[model samples]
Target: VLTTFDLDEYVHAALRAGASGFLLKDARPDELLAGIRAVAGGDAVIAPALTRRLLDEFARYGSAPTDDPRVDRLTEREREILVAIGRGWTNGEIAARLVLSESTVKTHVGRVLAKTGARDRVQAVIFAYDLGLARPSVR
Candidate 1:
């Protein structure tokens, strides 16, 4: 997505609509092409300048991790795995942190995605963010 608007709300809407990448209209030609290629390759991207604000929005506004019923179906262990996924941890990282095998972590992740109705890891991450189960670390 290339647009002149720098508003956070629009960015959020686009992301919610499954935009694989976002770039400002002012982005360099190379950057635009790369973003397109990355999106085409089934990766997501966000403009560098908007990344901090996007993270901040998650940190500043997130609430109700405990109260949300969207996570009600998850087991306690699965919830932990979801939070780790939301923190952008790899399966290996989650395995190390949780003292579990990589296969176990992968299985937990699959269960989390299925239980939460998330189509993929990226959707699971978004779900975690929306449910306030994960947060960006403040520096």
Candidate 2:
């Protein structure tokens, strides 16, 4: 329901205000419906275009994962989850690949979020890629 112009400000504000998810103004009806459902189910969703913009912004900022204290605090397992996130893997995919339950994967994702100080998975992925934490092989 939010426009892309204010995405960065809104996303951060929404998080502070406890809002669940975000969508671009140009989102298709079906995509909007899916986003709502995902948020209702305790998932975060980002439009592909918006995700690209976020990555661009992250790169512009030059706050790579390795330079971040929070990212440095992550365990190896959390780093693995971060790389998977960077590869655009779903929780189910990451879980299946790692031989873990979906819930366990979610836990690791949450830990990664906390440790990386990321506003969301998209930002975490950007951080991972920017810092070279995620390799091309993973992608």
The lDDT leader among the candidates is 1
TM-score of 2: 0.65
C-alpha local distance difference test of each model: 0.83, 0.73
TM-score of each: 0.72, 0.65
Candidate 1 on 1-139: residue-level lDDT in tens? 7999998998888887767677899999999999888777755678999988988887888556656665888999999999998898988999999999999998998899889877566677778888877888768
Model 1 misplaced regions, further than 4 Å: 2-4, 24-43
- State the displacement of the C-alpha of residue 17, model 2, in Å, after optimal TM-score superposition: 13
Model 1 lDDT at residue 15:
80
Question: How does model 1 score by TM-score?
Answer: 0.72
lDDT tens string, model 2, 21-122?
667778899999998897777567777666655555555664444576776699988888998998779999999999999999999999998877776775
Question: Runs in model 2 with CA error above 4 Å?
Answer: 4-22, 40-42, 49-65, 135-139
Clashes of each: 0, 0
